[model samples]
Target: MSGAKSVSPENRTVIGLTFGNSNSSIAYTVDDKAEVIANEDGDRQIPTILSYVDGDEYYGQQAKAFLIRNPNNTVAYFRDFLGKDFEHIDPTHNHASAHPKDVDGAVSFTIKDKAEEDAEPSTVSVSEVATRYLRRLVGSASDYLGKKVTSAVITVPTNFNDKQKAALLAAANAADLEVLQLISEPVAAALAYDARPEAQVEDKIVVVAELGGTRSDVAVIASRQGMYTVLATAHDYEFNGVALDKILMDHFAKEFLKRNPSAKDPRENARGLAKLKFEAEATKRALSIGANASFSVESLSDGIDFASTINRLRYETLSRTVFEGINRLVESVIKKAGLDVLDVDEVILSGGTAHTPRIASNFSNIFPQTTRILAPSTNPYAINPSELGARGAALQASLIQDYEADDIDQSTHAAVTTVAHISNAIGVVSLNAAGEEIFVPVVPAETAVPAKRTVHVAAPKDGGDVLVKFVEGNTHIKVTKPEPKPKEDKTAKVEDAADSDEESDFSDDDEEEEEKREKVWKIGNTLAEAAIRNVKKGGKVEVTVQVNADLSVILTTREVGAQGGVRGQLNA
Candidate 1:
């Protein structure tokens, strides 16, 4: 075993994980600096794909290449399967199918007949598939670092719920990582940009527009007192770079149908249509700079003849809907953040699709008052959209880990406390036996933790269990009564008779009545005043109650309990 002295802070590392619409990535921080170090593949970002081969071997990129040649044995693009049910696939899309048990819900793919028969029919859990992919990534990182990595900080979408967060945490555990924290993706990007000397600016509200192949997300961020906070976030899963490509595919399909009128086979058309989608994406990228570009689709069933030339303007026009969706998302996020367009100081663009001029131009038109967009200076010769998100995640992990180190000695104050115990019976203030409701509060959620209060309650005529249901928020407490409704006429008649007889009752009311009441009951002898007098200085008269993630309560007081300390109980 390695000695404690051998395990230094330098050996401790934090890894960041991000899953976008098109792909997913894992990034780790090396050294004290926030620079990102990629795996042995020389690519900073890894495609979120997985496949299993004979001899119990699993493959990623290389296997993806073999997908076209050996479709029976390969799998690709399994990230879409995350958080989806097996029967959720659309019937119209040929690619939509049930996920393999081994693959879980990370993605979908075609497998060999033998493999299918040998495998179980149940859908793979997202955690299982994500774990496999993350483990492979960790292995690659470990190989490069030549050290034992144990901890990581994964990134998820801002909208991820507790269950999704648990799924991610489980995957990290499966990948052999001790997850230190799970930061949101947009928050991570803000951290990445905020760390840069050129990117950091005080009192500036910046917008991050991320356009990936499968989805697009926009977030507004503000920095205050060296802390970067995400003001708002918006995302559209359907409106992505792929949607732009599909628009072009529709145009190409019309032309293909016009030329190949006799083609009838469904499989042949599917293959042709798939190829056209790829071509459309390539052409779309090409037209970003070039005024026009011509693409050729060779080896159609009829012959090598499917080809077309598209201008930049025509391509932009065809993809108008996608551009509109992006604009709406950007506007909506800014609006949600309670900021006007002019309030934005800078606009930072990232993601794979941001490489297109049309995307940038659309953003410019929307935010005309803002300065030109700012992006990392990259070699125009080769561009990879995946690098931005990964780098951002790495930067975030570094910032958080650094903050943890710097603020090690600083204590965090508790924002909320738990309730100890109910002091008084909560009931509505009512008049007479009829009980007209007024103010009522049995228990409030924000009561101090581990608190005990003695409440005086009226004994019910018919003794039974007094059901106590704790509620939260500013609303009237609901009560269930066993008695039926009383007649209004009977109540009115009693009030009328009492008013008429009250004149003589007041005649005997003054000095004699006051002396008689004082002799009967002391006015100053209330239980509340007596309890307050006994409360000693520095002594916990009221217990502080704290609730945990499992909704368990921890009761602390000045005096210790028989268990040798404070009382702690887990609620069933």
Candidate 2:
């Protein structure tokens, strides 16, 4: 069961697009071979920033460099506002003081005038900003290869819901890109690792720890035969490399504010603070391989200079909380996957923060025996961390093409099950005749997807409404308060005679001899036929139950007249 397979030559070109909060990357393969290229600035990663100037023109880094002089006209990091709601913004998280308004489900920010605006300000949609950045990347790649690029596979976070994914797709489409697929980040990483020549094919579990600029995600994947599947995923959007840098910057900022108390205006200090944050990030990286690093902040207000030196130990201490949060998530994910430390064969590290040695050391300490942390191999034209995702995406695109071309019959493969056995099957909740709720197990969890099973329920005696509540997951039924019993009539009691002892004994024997009551049969038709009749067109009708090796259940309908019956199997 070697994972290795040969790729066929194809006419269409496949490109991979990996977008992150702080940066975005693109990769492509030509004739089943990986092709690498650089942007017009000779850098693989074009900064994920956009600047709008007067006269209906927009720019990126070239425009960004002039931000200090033209802060009034520049807009950066507009991608953060894409697909976000007006009420979702937190002042603490957003750098821009003026919040953007919603326009057709997209945020629109207005570039305001510095002085009292006698003139009108310009407004731009978040989608338009994102489209500009995407188009720039696509156009740069197309120019470098001298071809007209059409389609791409974009990578997104595992936590992105349908709406966010849709917004991104729309943005890419607006940029003139025919999207091939939208893949999860860790899934892409797994694909990248699985494509390596030295990679082994087995049921090995790998966790991808992505610590990026604004978020962190940990995903566990298991490789079986030639296919890869996600076992579990967890992420914290607030935890990221930028926060780590800010932790260091905050400490330095506190000391600077104390020394120069008069320098209090945040707007005036924006450029200097931005520069300091960059220095902090560089120092953080440098400390990963070294014991100590020094950072200097030149010319504060009143011609004052400030400098600080931090050691590896101090940096680690400052980042202790971040490390703990990551460890907690990793451990939780392992537990959720029902696996122990011994089960994980590898720990694939990516993102900007993963480049730090301290972070790597912490991860090593958490899963020392089974984890093997590997840095992404550097690409000639791209940043190692940023390109890993895009390269992995490219590898997936190639695999998908191969898979489609072969037209492999998936039915030949054995269905994998998550549930070993149905100790307690899933059932619908219904109220009994006594007005008491009870759960009737129908189909259980870990039961394969698209599964159907039915349990017989009694029809109401009076033909009242009988609502069948089908709920997912195992939840306990709530008990209702019982009604008080009516008092028995005292006048109807028959007194026992105190006459002869024999007569009393005879009466007691007669009481025992009284006929034992039996439950009477009630007249009501079963609701099973009604349920069958209620099955809508194209809906699955439960008839027979079949459990697979994976503990998933499949339901077959009753045999049709004359013709053979159609059978439907459960999906994994």
Candidate 3:
């Protein structure tokens, strides 16, 4: 209670939180009912951003505003790199913030000098940036709640591994807030829906498709007796509001160039492109409700104004690829859950992109008409489509507090429920005679958590080491090579200039053919490994792997028919 805020024995104030890649929100229970608490901006949800200018820190709208002026000092989309190393990040997903440099295998950003915009940069870890943002968020919540908010229940993606969870907890700790629970995003959404007064009390398979600012996650839930369980889940980072923003951004940039042929390219102007991105977001939101939207930015580039109009048809056309990606994720998750679309009773759409008309139409086209499409929440708190997770998380916070108090009251929405399974596949890597790596799945994605599977793998010739490595989810590595350039025919042109049938001495094969290898790097952390011995060539080894609801992985391996096996929790 002295160094950092703590829950007072007299007044216990707890909040529910949902932290997103681009935005975040908080809510609390008052009088046994949950409602989103508005910040200084009068909005339930705020931008998850932070900026440093001349050693002065800013957050939320202020930080977002600073982005256009000082793109390098402002950190946004830091959530994507949380719990990840520099090697794991795809270079194609780069943004305006200073490139993340490797600091002892950890991801960190080099913030350009805030005191003298052109001075050398300073370094900060990704978690440090997140901590700053969370600190601001806690302060805002405390101000709104009229007390010190000490504890929180935050929602995270189901596929989040232990490293990500730990990083999130560290951020909370830095803000002087105690983390009470870490609920899955889909589970939180389902909880919010089930708590609705109009919710039907029945057992049914539901698909919760959450299309957020920078990613889309689909989860299959088995709702029974007002309780929710996550069955299967899939996510597409490329199919999100950020993708739509790029499409709109490019369209406007092209239109601006067309209007002024002598104008410099907008992409080369950081501040101008930043402003364009902001307008693009507004245009996207506007197009969500109307058939047409216009993008305008005054003095967008070097005293030149830019404006463009986008019809729904064009918007849909540009977004077709992203829609297909989301569609695939939804289908993949349902398929991973071992259920057909016909088996699904309801398809609930959440997240900001769910408000888009075409996204809804796409879902309707994918699922049967009888499956029923649930729209965004019509709750009284004015929680946006993106705020569902936080709202539900906040509601769960109340349930947790009541449970801790030994007061299991129905009014608090306490129920007998459990998160039955994980959202992604867990497996080991194997190599065939050809030396090609193959992902031999042990516990397939969507398998119930607290589950285990034993697979038999043939032993290597003689007493070779038995290897049993585990990965958290599905992994795919892709390699691409640039096509070789065609050889030029300079001699042919010279001969044509002479108007004679004469050829130069230079050989057509003079150009050396450089061999190009398509490099493919596997992206996965080896969660566990094991050693085996004393197995014949034909004999197999039993490798057992189990993942619990908390994402702790256990791997055991031994020769077939052996009395004991080697086991490890794979914390590292």
TM-score of each: 0.60, 0.64, 0.68
**Top model number, lDDT:** 3
lDDT of 2 by residue, 456-492 (tens): 5554443333334433334332334334334373233
Per-residue lDDT of 1-572 in model 3, one digit per residue for the tens?
12223343335578899888778898887765668888988867688888888878877878888878887788878786788888986534347755677999888888753577577878889888888888888899999978888788888887888788878878778878877667888878877777776667766778988889888889898764455667778888889898999999988888888888888878788888789888999999999878899888998887898777889888888888888788789989988977677667888778888877777666765665677777633223323566678878888887666343323222232232335555456667777788777667676544545567788876665646666666655533233444554549756645553542221111222222312222132425567677666666677888788776577778888888877889888541
Q: What's the distance in Å from true for residue 549, model 3?
A: 14
Q: Model 3, which residues run further than 4 Å from truth?
A: 1-11, 91-94, 112-121, 376-383, 403-572
- Residue 455 lDDT, candidate 3, scale 0-100: 88
Per-candidate clashes, comma-separated: 21, 6, 3
Which regions in candidate 1 have their CA more than 4 angstroms from the true location?
1-11, 26-42, 55-60, 66-123, 264-268, 289-309, 375-385, 400-572
Off by over 4 Å in 2: 1-12, 30-36, 54-81, 89-93, 96-99, 103-105, 112-119, 255-268, 376-383, 400-572
Model 1, 141-230: lDDT tens digits are 677667766666666666666656666666667677755555666556656666555554454566878777776878876643234457
Error of 2 at 358 (Å): 1.1
Positional deviation of 140 in candidate 2, in angstroms? 1.5
Scored against the true structure, residue 502 in model 2 reaches a CA lDDT of 29
